[model samples]
Target chain A: MVLEATLRGIRLVGDRTLRIVERIGATVAFLVMTLVHSATSFRRFDLVIREIFFAGVQSLIIILVSGLFVGMVLGLQGHETLQNYGSEQSVGVLVALSLVRELGPVVAALLFASRAGSAITAEIGLMKATEQLSAMEMMAINPIARVVAPRFWGGVISMPLLAMLFSAMGIIGGFLVAVVLIGVDDGAFWSQMQAAVDFRHDIVNGIIKSLVFGVAVSAIATFEGYEAPPTAEGVSGATTRTVVSSSLAILALDLVLTAFMLKGWN
Target chain B: MERSTLNLWVGVFVLLGFFAFLVLAFKVGNLSAGGNGTTYTLIAHFDNIGQLKERAPVRSAGVLVGRVKSVRFDPVHYNAEVQMAIDTKFPFPKDTSASVLTSGILGEQYIGLDAGGDEKMLKDGDEIKLVQGAVVLERLIGQFLFNKAQDSGADKGAQK
Candidate 1:
């Protein structure tokens, strides 16, 4: 009896695991289809340029403000902690390394998810809800090529640039707080950061992370929208799913990428 | 909005992104000042590298001239073999001695070069002959205590 019950429980878990694998396979297929359509969409590059403005330009303000405040907080906290050990001069290194390695890309992506990601989902979901997608199909128009591809390409192009801006601004904010405001030696601030932060190791890794996050976030946002039910409630649910799932995806991918990158270091 | 205006904004955004990249590369990270220009490799041997790591800076008389490219253990020699990429701009005499030195107290260790009066200069792939390993703090304290004990012992003998 106990053996039979255990066998049933194992089968239950195996069934659920298979379901998740099936869902992942479907998502990947959808993403590949979107990319295939995006090839033709590239002919009308104006649509992508417009989407870039909407997705990237519109999200710049929040990214810059959050970046500056985060850097200032890092500077204040780092100085307070390092001063105890009489190493306040190294605050710049602390701020730069942490921002470049962890905070800048991850935080910027989280913000982008809420800002542009939700917008894309809502727009696409609303189009589906209003039967606009059906109307496009009736016109023999390819909605994925015309609508989805542009947004996907825009987001992919924008994420790394936004991340770079965040890192650059945060470093400036940190310098202002640590050197100008808190009276740490200015030369030590920049020089120590230069010594500690390697271009290929830290900066390039940060760029790579933002690019990965961009692809994951854009894919999740677009997929959720395209698959949403043609109703107000379903569209709303997909928008929420876009934000939550993409946020989780960004963090999980960051962990995996960080582990792989750090292993390359001695 | 005007089509030209929209195009202008996108162009501006892309330009801003590239500018941000430049600032990050030069200001935040050391892409401009690092071992980027022309650099030649030099090898050194150390008994104990302690906590020295790859990409550590190499300085000659407090001025940075290169970077440590790699660190490996030589099985036959039983010593640490370090490869440094030194800038071609700063050439050192072949007889220069390399010493691993720490900055301040509890700071990161770097390789420091003391130039000799040799006529020849260190070339690419040349191995530095004189190399001093990192100074471990515990070993220094132990040596100091041992010398103090010996001095007190001699004092006690003279009194007796």
Candidate 2:
């Protein structure tokens, strides 16, 4: 009897796992459909513009502050390490390289996912819980185009811009810490940075990484919100899931993209 | 926000982003969108390139005059051929000697030019005859260790 019970328990767990996987597959397919439909119906572009403002412009301040602090921290740490080897003057190169190549995109994406992505999820979840999505569906309008598509496009378009701003702020922050605070020669700092970082290699790759993360985080947020159980607790749960999952996705995508993009860069 | 106002802010935001991108590319990445302004090419041959790379600064009297345009190996001469683009404004003599130098102990390699007292200037497609190859640190360390071993061996032989 115990052996039969153990087998039954194993079968139940396997079935549950398959159901979760199937749900995820369905969500991804729906997201792709929404994206395609939104792309085709471009007449209501004002909605997209509004979303750009909400998702992109609204999150600018936090991204800048985080970028500035991160850059300063990197500069301080890089200075201490480089000073031991008498190569402190190359701190600018070190800071610019690290920010432009890795931290700028990854950190900015994490912040973006936390700030704007959560807001997106909450907004959509509330709309669903309050029956607005159902009302739109009853009225024969596709909620995906009217609701999710604009936000998705907004996130995608804004990601690279936010990432660029973050990196620029970071460069300036590093300058302040390395040059003004540490007394490294201003000329050496700028010159070495200019010489070492490559336009196509570092800058373009970083932008691409941010763009990919933007698509992923926004898709996850929208999917979770759209599919959340239509209840108060469900909305809050979706919001939490948006933040947690998007952050993890950003980190995971960053690793895969970095591995592909940064090959032969050394 | 009104549609017009929103459009304006969006425009401004995009402009700022583009401007920042330009700064990153041109200022930080050392890529210039402008044409190579009135430059001439000069070639130098080196025995070994070591860590020399294309776009390495070519400096004269501690001032940057040009950059390495390209680097290739001349199979016939069994040497590395480096093409440099010197700014026309900072022309040097035909007999100027170029030597590969390191910025610091663990820094990048660059070409340093010592201008000679020649009246004529180096023109386009001219080859700099006097060229010194890069100083490889590993080779230097190996030579130092070899010499120390030889000296110790000689001292032991004398004692015997």
- Report the Cα lDDT for candidate 1: 0.91
Off by over 4 Å in 2: A1-28, A180-183, A264-266, B1-12, B32-47, B52-100, B111-133, B137-160
Chain B TM (all candidates): 0.94, 0.78
Compare the candidates by DockQ and give the number of the best one. Answer: 1
* A1-266: candidate 1 lDDT, tens digit per residue: 99999999999999999986776677678789899999855899999999889888888899989999999999999999999999999999999999998899999999999999999999999998899988999999999998899999999999998998898889888988999999999999998898778888899999999999998888888888988998899999999989998999899999999999998655
Q: Lowest summed lDDT over 10 consecutive residues: which window, candidate 1 chain B? A: B27-36
Judged by DockQ cut-offs, is candidate 2 incorrect, acceptable, medium or high? acceptable
lDDT of 2 at B37: 56
- Against the true structure, candidate 1 reaches a TM-score of 0.92
lDDT of 1 by residue, B1-160 (tens): 7778888888888888899888878887888885368899999999988888988889998999999999999999999999999999989999999999997777788999999999999999999999999998899999999999999999999999
Give the per-residue lDDT digits (tens) of candidate 2, residues B48-74.
Answer: 988899878888998878889999999
Give the per-residue Cα lDDT of candidate 1 at A204: 91
Q: Score candidate 2 by TM-score against the native.
A: 0.76
The model with the greatest lDDT is 1
